[model samples]
Target: MNPTLHSWLERRRDWLGLAVLCAVIFVVMPLAFDVFRLNLIGKYLSYAFVAVGLVLCWGYGGILSLGQGVFFGLGGYCMAMFLKLEASDPVSTKIQSTPGIPDFMDWNQLTALPLFWEPFRHFGFAVVAVVLVPTLLALLIGIAMFKRRVGDVYFSIVTQAIAAILSILIIGQQGWTGGVNGITDLKTLLGWDIRTDSAKLILYFVTAGLLVGCIVLGRFILRSKLGRLLMAMRDKEERVRFSGYDVASFKVFVFCVAAAMSAIGGAMFTLQVGFMSPSFVGIVPSIEMVIYAAVGGRLSLLGAVYGTLLVNFGKTYFSESFPQLWLFLMGGLFIAVVMYFPNGLAGLYDSHGRKWIARLLQGRRAAAKPAPGAAAQG
Candidate 1:
């Protein structure tokens, strides 16, 4: 029985790690933090989704996309469009020059609704778009890049360029998008007052639950044969192709999946934060998203969550108190993490923390052992 339990621990330690993470996020955090702080954690957890996606796409699959924010923004904008439509119902916008259209559109002097936003009036379509739009965009991008054998630093550059293009387009087309200000003034979701404390608590729970689901999905992928193939492709793409696997297909799959995860986070961000912006869709936030993944231990899904929370919390605290020093501190933190803990926080825990845990368990096992004669009699 002891051996069986030990073997189980050896085989499924990652599951135990995930369970502990989920417990902290769902239980301990809610108990420890006030409503406002809890809500802030939820907002940070939204980026955790993107970081986890990066684990699968960049860490394991060797696809470093610098433009994950594009998917994040796309998903967010989809949700924002729906909420904006609901908020701009004729009665609410009666005083506007053009009632029933978004105020930004009115401010920009647009007389009619944009063709693209028409589909978001329905809640179901908006929800679907949150996932589908990002997935489709990623699929197209992946096909274009991967099919032609473009990858590594070049792929990263292309994605960055794509982010820049989207940000410029959104800002330039003020009548369609919200311009530099992006989308704002989002109020409700399916008649629920999203601004209320109770609603914020509920939304935090929803985000936590969804995040758990994504973690489970990532774990399943990582443990599967496809995951092995991804690692192999990452290390030796030519060898993987020589082995008759469709390397491009695997790359495309991981990229699209990552985009979907980021999109879901973006949608939730819109719900929790009450807005979407090109600022998040631009190169800076996108790279910061990568930093979140790197700091979390790119290979560890749970690490991503903790890393994002820690980094963002620090950013908030320092930017408020020592704004000028924040950037330098952030740079130093990144360098320290990379140089000393290449695998991020999770790697540190795995290397040192797990050794201590193993020693303690072994000591307990030794102490629990019965006398030789007594064991024979039993």
Candidate 2:
């Protein structure tokens, strides 16, 4: 085949793969599952945001961040602050000593909303903060570390430390951060009750839509010059740097992009689950997000989403059926994936599935073609 034709065919295949994923999320799953299960899937999809970001950061950029939950939590908390504030209107909290403050604040003996919480009352500001706060933090961390030449395991350790510190900070500040329980009972978004089944369904679609958008954006990035540069930097950072490229700048940019994506996931998670807490801001969930990317094939964007759904579904099933054995089972699954299919589900498909598909298509084409005798007669 001509090179141009091959490129077009490859692009067409990618679009087809994406369309199949969309059908599963937007059509098949919703039709098959009840609202409750669909809502759970939405929650699972929320985590896929992190996995997708991991693909760009770790798989392509070669920047492994174990503290992604920090950004995820920040985004969740930003949105939660707005929701919590709306839920704590003066009329709603009239029974509390602090009539216009969060219940946790009132319970903590606060007299008025803290200055920091005051701004979250505005929905517009909260929306911007959801994406901006995490990106800004990532920017700071990236500049500090990348510029200083921090890479490899050292950078990973630093991220893990950040996750631990942020979790502790949230848990320690009960009056403001909702302490160990984090933020709960988020009842409304602009006075539309989010707890309703209808609202949950809407939120699920919204999450799915955003996730699809993110995947597309990831695809675009990977196809661009920047994407090529990222791959180059990942494999040959010093060579690229010596070849007149600013390696640190590329690292920072991709890291910030990853942070923004993870933050969006966190925000959606809060919307779907009706709460945000330190539980998600810690080391464990951050590690789990990495597992999602790892299991999905970090180099494959759509694979990340499938990996997330598969793992979360497995987690739910095993936990409910064999609670005591779920952890061991999960560990075994990870080991199995690493040992058997190191590049993840996408790798498996690339190695075997694509070949099978190609052969099937070839066989069909051959069958549809007229025999030589029939062609001669015609």
Candidate 3:
């Protein structure tokens, strides 16, 4: 162990300050904004979920995935189906609602509810499907691609195409999936009135809980043996393979974890916003997730949390002021970050940088001082 390096690393900063800041925000922000602000922040936390997974794949695994939005929406739609099924009033209020079916199914001229939709009637099953489906897909994709050594630009293109296709398919399935209009006007979730403030708070708490748990979980994973193996693979895959490790299996495991995280984010999003649309799950949104991860500081998990908040805040501010140009503005922001900060925000506080800076300063001071032997002899 290098004493100089250890000293610098230990002197820099502890997680204590960050921990206190989190406590303060969670406690103080709710008081300032009533239920509306709290709920909105909760929705933002779901975006943090996407950032977390991006940090894992892009940050540690060196895999650039631009289709997290597809997984997110998959989970969302699954949860939406259950909520819609449990929603007696939404079904009844629908102009075309029949004796036992929801409005959309009847309006689409469907004689009976699809058997696929039957499992969603049970919230537990829907929740499990929401998580597992995306995970399994990620597993299969990661196994095939990693085993074949297809990565970098090719991988990005394939994943981006996946997101685009999923969005288009959802929009085209008007009869079964509600198409472009999306599943909206939701009324209740698990017998709780969706419109009530209490329900909103519950959803908000759920999102907060998930975000905290994920942060802890991500940090734990990064510190564990598996996390070390992932970093090694990212830095040099062929070397790791020669060292007797199964590279494909490691990649697939991380990929599945990332997909499940994105799905959880999506499910929480549906619960909060009361809607799920094709537009939200498109290629653009997936790229935006990558941008958020990059901007937030990929190396540090906490970077994702703040990156989502900052980017979303920018979107809200710019969209309100320049509705027609917000997309361009966002693109510009992304370009600016990539051009200026290659490693993203996390690079700013990296251990190596901090240690180097300290070393440079110490060297300059030492060079300026008189020699110890000369002074003693004098």
Candidate 4:
């Protein structure tokens, strides 16, 4: 085949993979599952947003951040704050001493809303903050770390420390962050009750749509000149730096993009799950998010989504069936993936599945062709 044609075919295959994933999320899953299960999948998909970000930051840019949960939590909290305020209207909270303040704030003897929380009263601000807050924080971290040439395991450790610190701060500030419980009682968005079944169904599609958008955006990045530069920097950072390129800037940009993506996921999670907590903004969940990327083939964006769904499904099934062994089971699964399938599911497909698909297509083409010399006989 001509090189140009082969490249075009490869591009089509990539798009085809995305189309299949869309079908699973939008068409098949909705048709196959009930509302409750669909909502659960929505929650899983929210986590997938983080996994997708990891593919770019870790898989492509070679930036392994173990504190993505902090960004996720920040985005979740930003949205949760807005929702909590909406639900804290005077009529609803009339029983509390401070009817206009959140219930937790009232319980903590706060007579007025904090200055920081006041801005969240507007839904638009919360939406903007969801993406902006995390990205800005990532920018700061990136500049401080990348400019100093801190990376590899050191960067990962620093991210984990940040996650731990953020978790403690949120839990310590009960009045402001809902304390250990994080943020809860998120009931509505712009007076629309999010608790209803119909609302959940809609939210699931919204999450799915946003997830697809993120994947598309990620694919665009990976196809651009910057994408090639990221891979170059990842593999040969010193060489790229010496070649007149600003290596630190590229790293900072990708890290911030990953942060923004994770934040979007966090915001969606708050909307779909109806709560946000310190548990999600900590070390454990951050590590698990990385595992999702690893299991899905960090090099493959769509694989990240599938990896998250498969792992979470296993978690749910095992926890319900053999609660005592679920942790071990999950651990074993991760170990197996790392040991036997280092490239993850996407790697498996590339090695074997793609070959089988190609053969099948070839066979069909051969069968479609007319017998040799048949036209001459006619």
**Pairs of colliding residues, candidate 2:** none
What are the candidates' C-alpha RMSDs?
Answer: 2.3, 1.7, 5.6, 1.6
The lDDT per prediction is: 0.93, 0.94, 0.82, 0.94
lDDT of 4: 0.94
lDDT of 1 by residue, 74-169 (tens): 999999999999999999999999999999999999999988889999999999999999999999999999999999999999999999999999
Candidate 2, residues 1-378, lDDT tens digits: the string is 346544655668789899999999999999999999999999999999999999999999999999999999999999999999999889999999869899999899989888998889999999999999999999999999999999999999999999999999999999989999999999999999999999999999999999999999999999999999999999989999999999999999999999999999999999999999999999999999999999999999999999999899999999999999999998898899999999999999988877686667667878999999998999
Model 3 over residues 110-139: C-alpha lDDT tens digits? 867788888888978998998998999898
lDDT of 4 by residue, 1-378 (tens): 346544655769889999999999999999999999999999999999999999999999999999999999999999999999999999999999879999999999999899988999999999999999999999999999999999999999999999999999999999888899878988999989999999999999999999999999999999999999999999999999999999999999999999999999999999999999999999999999999999999999999999999899999998999999999998899899899889999998888877787667767877999887996787
Off by over 4 Å in 4: 1-8, 373-378
**TM of each candidate vs. truth:** 0.95, 0.97, 0.86, 0.97
Q: Candidate 3 overall Cα lDDT vs. reference? A: 0.82
